[model samples]
Target: MSLRSSYYLPPQQLRAENLDSPLGLHTRNPQLSWKLRWNERGAAQATVRVVAAASCSALLNRDYLWDSGELRTDATEITYAGATLTSRQRVYWQVQVLDESNRITQWSEVTFFEMGLLTLEDWNSQATWLGNHGITVPLYRLSFHLDQVREDICTARLYSTGIGYYEPRLNGNKLGTQALAPEYTDYDKRIVYNTFDIEKQLCSGENVLGIILAGGYATRYQYGTPVFRAQLEILYHNGQQQLVDTASGPWLVSPGPWRDCDIFNGEWYDARLEQRGWDAPGFIAHEGIWQEVKPSNPCSSTDAPKGELVGTYAQTVEPPK
Candidate 1:
C-alpha cells in the first residue's frame, strides 16, 4: 500500500486524503467526543458498534449521534444496524457534551469510514479461477481486475442462468449470495443474477472481487466443458454489456449392470468474443441454443485454442462507469 498526503493543517496537525483521516484534538473537559469514518470490506450484514470512555461518567452522553442519525441515549455504547448502515455504508459520528446549564460545552472533530468491501487478495483469487478456466480470455470474455481510486462510490453486480449461485465479496468482506435458484430449463429461465451499489465501500487503493460458480456438474466426462462464459461488449459504462451461459449434462442416464455406459459423450464448449478497437461483439456455444441469435465465428480470435494453457495475471484496466 502507498500513502499520499492530502492537506496539512497548521496549528493542529491533521491530514485528510482519499478515505482516510488522521486528526488530533485536545480538550479540557476530561472527555473526548468525536466521530470517525473508514472503509470496510464485505460487511453487508453486520453492524457498526461505537464505544467511548472518558475520565468522568458525566462525560458520557445521552444525546450523541453515531453515524446512523439515531440518538445515543440508551448507553455510552451505540450500535447502528438493521438498515443501510448494516450493509455497505459510510458513517459519520458526532459527540457533544452539555455543560451544567444544559448548553453544549464541547464538540469533537468529525471522522468518516466505509465498511464492507473486498481486498486485493480477494479479487486476485477470483481472477485466478476465471483465468485458469478461460473465463478471462481477452476478446472471448470481458476480462477485468479490481482497482482502487479516490472515488466516494462503490458497487457490483452478478448475473447468471441455470440454477446460478454465487458468493460475492467487496474488498475483503463477503456480501452474501446474489442469486439462488434450484431449477433451470430454458436459457432465459436458467439465469441467476445480483448487483451491488457499493460506492461507500471503496478504499483509496485497495479493491477486490471474489466470486464462485456453483451450478456446474462434477462428472469426469464433463471436465473440459466451459461451464462459465462471460463477454464484455463495451469497455466503458455507457455501452458495456455482459452475456453469460452455463450448462450441465447426463443427469438421468446410468450404466447398465453389466456394462459401463457413456451417456454423455459429446463435449461442452463456452466462448466469449470482444473486438479490441471495434464495437462488434461475438459469442458461440455448442451445448444447446436458447434464442435464434447469430452464432459466433468459431475461427475468430475470441475462441481459445484447444489444449492451450492461457497465462494468468494478464489483464487490462478501464475507468469505472
Candidate 2:
C-alpha cells in the first residue's frame, strides 16, 4: 500500500560546530549562524581549503574561504583524494572573507609549511653551536733533544685563552715558562723565533718532544684552586728546524723583537751547561789528539822557527834506510 511520508520537527534543531571559527559563543542564537565547507587542495595533497558562511533559510553564503595553495587571493585550491603529502612537499594557503553586503573581503593571512630538504647554507649565518673549543692565543717553547743519535732540535708552540699562563718543554729539557704579570711592560703576549739549533742536544731518529702549557697564574689565585694546564707531545726525526712561534705582548712599551732575545741570545747555552754543572763534564768526552804540536824553545828566534815561514810548511819523507 502507498503511504504518505510525514516529517515531524524535533524540540532542538541540529547544528554543526566549527572548531576553527573565531566568533563569540551564542547558544541557539538565530541571528548568527555559520556554515563550514572544506575540500582537499593541491595535486600533492599538501594543502587544505576551508570555507565559512552565515545564512537564514536558503543556502548559506560563504563569508570566508581559506585555501591551501599559492598563498594568494586568486590562487586555486588544491585537491587530493587518495594521495598523502610527501616529506619533501611544500604547502601554502590563504583565507577569504565576505561582509554583510555580500561584498567579498580581502584574502586573509597566508600560511606556509615545508618539510625536509633543509640546507646548511640557511643556517651558516648563525652563531656557532654551544661547547665549541679552540685556541685563543699563540705561544711556544724552544728546546733540544739529547737522547737522539742523529741530533735534532725540538720546539713547542702554545696559545692563551685570556686567562693563565704556560710553560713549554722539548724532549726532557724545559725550554722556558710563559707567565703573565700585571705590572710587567708586556703581558699575555706570544714569543716567536726564526730557528732553534738544538743539534748540540738533539740526537738522531725517533725523538719525543713535548710542550707543557701551564694555564694557572700565581698572582690571580685566591686560595687552593689549581690553574688549568695542557700538555702536547710530538714524535719527530731529523728535519729542518723552522721557527713558527710569535710574540703577542699587550704592553706598548717596546718595539724590539722579544723572541730574538730569548732564542737567539747565547744565554741558552750557558744556562744549559751551568744547570748540568758537574754532570755535564761526564757526558762530553775530550780527544787528546792535537791538531799541531811544536817543541817549546824559549831561546829560539820569535820571527820564525828554523826556515819555516808563516804560510810555508815542509813535508819530509824518511829514506829507505
Candidate 3:
C-alpha cells in the first residue's frame, strides 16, 4: 500500500485569510492554509492544487473561479490570486496534495471566505453615522417596508459598527453570534466594522432594524456617548440591488432600560422599563418617547471621537459552546 493509504490523512483545519470560513473578509488577496496529518515525520508535500468556485457544488464539479494548477512546492499556505473579488462575494475552495512519492491525496474539506466592502469610497459614499448625542445607552430603531420585487432575493448583507459596543437586531432577532463588537480599537485611529448575513432574517415586508449601543471600550475614567452606523445591501436573483442605510432614513432613538452603564462599575438595568416589541414590526411608540437621530460626520470633523471605519480583522468571540 502507498504512504497515502497507510499514513496520510486529508488536509485538516483549512483556513482562509488566517480565519476559518470567515465572513466579510476585506482582503482582495486572501491567503489559504491547511495542516497536514501523517504518521511519518519526514513525509512532505511535493505539490499542491487549490481550486475555488462561487458555490460548493460548482467547486466539486470543477467549475472553478480560480485554480492553481499543480504547484511544485511544499508550502502549506498560498495566497489567492483569483478573479477579481467584489463586495459580498462568497467563494468556496478546497485543496489537494501530492506526496514526495508522487502519490496524490484526496481533496481537503471545503472552506469559504466572503468579501467585504473593497474600497474606502464604498463606505464614504454609502453610510452615514446616526446617534443620539446625549444618551449614554440608546436604542436606535428603523422600520421600513420591502415591496415585492420582480425577482427573488439572492442575498442580503448588513455592515455595522459603533463607537462603543453594540447589539443589533433584525425583526426582533439578534444579528450575529458575536458579542461586544465591533471590537475595541483606538478611537483616534480606526474603527472595526462587522458584517452579518441577514438574508435568512429578512421577511417579505415591514422589517425593523434595531441597535442598542453601550459604552463598552470607548469609555474609561469618564463616560462617553456612543454613535452607530449601518448599511444593508440586498441583491436580487436578476442582478437587481437595493440598499437600506441609517443615512437619509427615518431612524428613531430612545433611551434604553439601562439607567447607568460602565465598564468597571457595571450596568444597571430595569426590566420594567423595557420597550416591548420596539425592535419588531408594527410597534407604535409612546408619544414623545423616541426622537430622531442626529447625523454625525466622522470624516470631516477632527474633534469627533470616532475614527476611520474598516472591516474587522479579529475573529468573533463567541460564548462557550
Candidate 4:
C-alpha cells in the first residue's frame, strides 16, 4: 500500500545567493535556497512557493514579478523581497515544495539572477583605476574581442573591485579559488563588488582579462591607493549588449612576483621577474606600461551598493568577527 506513498520528491539545489544557478548574482536581497531528497526520509518542510520573473516565458506564464505565496516557513534561505532589481536585470525563479505529508513537489528547476551594479548611478563604467604603484604583484592585462553578432551569449557578467587581494583570468583560465576576493569592506564606506558567471567564461572570439593584486585588508595598515575595477557584460543572442569595460581602451600594467604584498609584511616573490605564460590564451604585452585606469577613491555618491548591503533588514555587527 505504498506506491512511493503518493510521491512528492522534487526540490533540488535551486540556490541563488548561495549560488547554484547563479549568474551575475550581485545580491539584491537574493537568498532563496533548496534541497530535498526523498524516499520518505523525514520529508519535512510543509510548504513553499517562490516565483520571480522577467523571462522564461515570464516564469511559466504566471506573469510573475514576485510571488512567495505558500511559505509555511521551514526556510532554506529565502530573502528576496520582490521588484526593484536593476543593472543587467535578468531574474527568473521557481520553487514549490510542500511535504510533511501534504505531498507536492514538482516545480523546482528554473533559476536565474543577472543584476549587478546596484548603484553609484549603476556605474556608467568609465573603467579606470588600475595600478602598479611599486613593489610588485600587480599585473593587469586586458585583451578583448568577441563580436559574433547573431546573438548567442545570453548572459555573462563579471564585475570587480580591488584595493587588495584579487585574482581573475579568463581565456587562459584561473577564475575561482575563492580566497579573499573583492571582500573586506569599509573602504571609505562599503565598496565591494563581485558577480561572476562568465557563461562558461565565454568563447566566440578572442578573449582575455587578467588581473592580479595583493595587499589585503585593503592595504594592510598603511600606504593605500592600490586600486582596480573591471566589468564585463555580454548578453546577446539578439538582445544586444556587449561591454568589456575598465579604462575603456588599452591596458597592460605589469610588475609581478610581488616584491612586497604586506598583509602584515611577508611576501616578496620575484622568480626573476617571472612572466611565464602570464595566463596564456593569446598573451600579449610587448613589455608593460599602457595604463589608463585611475580613481581608487573619490567616487562616492553616498556609498552602500553591495546590493543594499545584502539583507532581510538586519545590520549590526560592530566587530562580530
Candidate 5:
C-alpha cells in the first residue's frame, strides 16, 4: 500500500488525566492518552510524539512547553513532564503517531487542560465565606465597575464553592452550562470547588455577579446553614491582575424564592417572591430588602465544615433540557 493511504488517522479522543480537555486539573503532572483508529486488522501504533504548548498558536509555531521527541513505543498514554505547572495555567497539546510500518499521520487536533489551585494558599488571604444568616435560600450579588481597568482583559476565571448547592451568574447569565454544582461532597470531610472561564461573560463598564444558594449537603448532612466562598481572577494582557472575591467586594444578599430547600426533602420556590432585576446591573432593592452578607460557616466554629478543599475533577452533571 502507498504510504499516503497506509498512514493511520491521527490519534483521537485526547484526554488529560482521563478527562476530555478538562478544566481545573489539580494534578501537577497529569497523564495524557489517546485512541488509535485504523481499518487494518493488524494496525498498530509503533511510535508517537506529543507536544504541549501554552497556546494553540504557540503549538502551531513549535514553541512548545514540552515535546516528547519520537519514542519507539506502542503505548497510547504518557505522563506529562513539562515545565512546572502553576495555578490557573492553561496548556494546549497535540500528538503525532506512526503506524506499525512507520507511516506517519498528521498532528492530532489540539486539546487543553487548565491547572487548578495547587495549594490552599492559592486562595486570597482576604477571601472569606459569605452567607445570608436569616434566609432559607439566599440570592447574593456583587456589583463592580471595570471601566477603570486600563489594560484589556486577557482572560478571567471564577473559582468557587458553597457549603450547599450553587448556581453562579455573571451579568444576569449563568457562568457555565452545567447545573447542580459545585459537586456534592461530604461537607464535614471535604468540599469541591468548581472553576469557570468567565471571559466572555464580563462586560467593559459594569458587571454584576449573582449566586443562588440552596441547602444541599450543608443542611441535609451537616445540619447547618449554607455559605459560599469565591474569587474571580482577571488577567490583563499587560500582566496586571485583578481579583474580586467575597471579602474584597461589597456584596449584598436577600432572601430568594427558594424556601425550605433540601437535597433530600426537595425545594420550595415561590414565583411571587421573586425579586426581579436583583441580579442585573443598575437594579436597586428597597433599603430593608437586601442587606450585607455576613461571614458564615457550616459549623459553629469558624470556617466550619473544616475539611479539605479540593478542585472538582470529576465529570459534572448536566440539567435536563
Candidate 6:
C-alpha cells in the first residue's frame, strides 16, 4: 500500500516509483518509474500495458485516450508517448503487467500528475518567502472564516512549498499521510510544491492554516537557510471562491520550536520551549515578533528564509515538520 496508504496494491503490480501524483510537475514525456517484487520463483515483469486518460473513473472503464498494448520491457521509466501535455494539464494513468510465468496481474490503481505553469504568463500568482530570510526554522499561520460551509465545496487545492521541508495543517489535521511535502529534488534546479484537496477539512466559519518548514536541502546540512511559499484556491459549487495565499494574505510568520534542526546534526527540541496549540486559530505568541511574508524564489540567488522546522516527519512522528 505504499502507492496509497488506504488500499493494498493488488498482487503482481510493481511497487510504483516516481508516480506519487507529483507536483510542480514538469517533463515532456512525464516518465513512469516503477519496480516489482521478485517471488524468488523466477517472477519478473515480462510485459506491461499502460492506460492513460484525463480522468480517474474513465481509466477503469477502458474509456481512455491512449493505450500501450503489452510491451515487453522491464524498463522502469516508461515515458508517456500518448499525447502532448500542456500547462496545468492533469493526466491519470494505470498499468498492468505480465509475469514471466504468463501470469497477468490486475490493473494497478490510478496515479496522476498535473503540469505546472508551462509559461511565464501561466504563473499569474507571485511567489513569497514564508518568514524572515535569515532564521533557521519558521512556522506560519493564518486564520480565516468560511462564512458558510457547503458540501458543494468541490475544488480545494493548497499549493504549497518551503525550502528544506514543510508540513501544512488545516484545523489541526495534517494534509496527508505522507510525511514529506513535495518530493525530494535539487533545490538549485527545481522546487516542488504540493497540491492538497482540503474540501472536507474545512469548517463553517473559523479555520486555521498553519505551515512549518525545516532545512532539508535548503540548508545543505545547515550550511544555508530555509524558505517557504504557498497558494490556496478554493472553488464552491455555487461558483463562489476563497483564497489564502502567502503572496498577499493574513499569514503571520513567527518563531517556533527546535533550537537547532539540521539534516546532519538532527533536531534539538526543549520541551520547555513548546507552545501548545500554537498552530490552532486564536493562539498567538510573541506577537510583535511576527512579520508579513514576501515573494522570493527558492531556486534563485535570492536569500532563503530561516527557522527550525517542527519535525523531520518520517524520522520523527511529530507535527509541524
Q: Taking the candidates one at a time, how many backbone clashes does each contain?
A: 40, 25, 0, 7, 0, 13
The TM-scores of all predictions, comma-separated, are: 0.24, 0.19, 0.86, 0.32, 0.89, 0.69
In model 6, the Cα lDDT at residue 139 comes to 69
Best-to-worst lDDT order: 5, 3, 4, 6, 1, 2
Worst ten in a row by lDDT for model 2: 248-257
Candidate 5 residue-wise lDDT, 15-129, digit = tens: 9988888878888889999998875788788888899999999987889899988888999999999888898899999988887777887678899999988788998854667
Model 3 error, position 156 (Å): 0.3
Per-residue lDDT of 169-221 in model 1, one digit per residue for the tens? Answer: 44445443322321222322222122234344434543333333343332232
User: Which lDDT tens digits does candidate 2 get at residues 226-287?
Assistant: 12222222223655433221121110111111121221222112232222211111222123
Poorly placed runs, candidate 5 (over 4 Å): 1-6, 39-41, 147-151, 294-301
Of 3 and 5, which scores higher on lDDT?
5
How far out, in Å, is residue 310 in model 3? 2.0
Q: Between which residue pairs do clashes occur in model 4?
A: 127-246, 127-247, 128-293, 129-293, 129-294, 151-237, 152-237
Sort every candidate by TM-score, greatest first: 5, 3, 6, 4, 1, 2
Candidate number of the best TM-score: 5
Over 16-44, each residue of candidate 3 has an lDDT whose tens digit, in order, gives 87787888877788889998886567788
* Model 6 C-alpha lDDT per residue in residues 32-120, reported as the tens digit of each score: 75555544556667777788888988886768767888788876557778878786567888776666666665667677766655544
Output the lDDT of residue 267, model 4.
82
Against the true structure, candidate 1 has what lDDT?
0.26
Q: Residue 317 of model 2: what lDDT?
A: 21
User: Which of 4 and 5 is the better model by lDDT?
Assistant: 5
Give the C-alpha miss distance for residue 291 in model 1, angstroms: 35
True lDDT of residue 7, candidate 4: 59
- Residue 215 lDDT in candidate 1: 31
Per-model RMSD to reference: 18.6, 35.0, 3.6, 16.5, 3.1, 7.0
lDDT for predicted candidate 3 compared with the true structure: 0.79
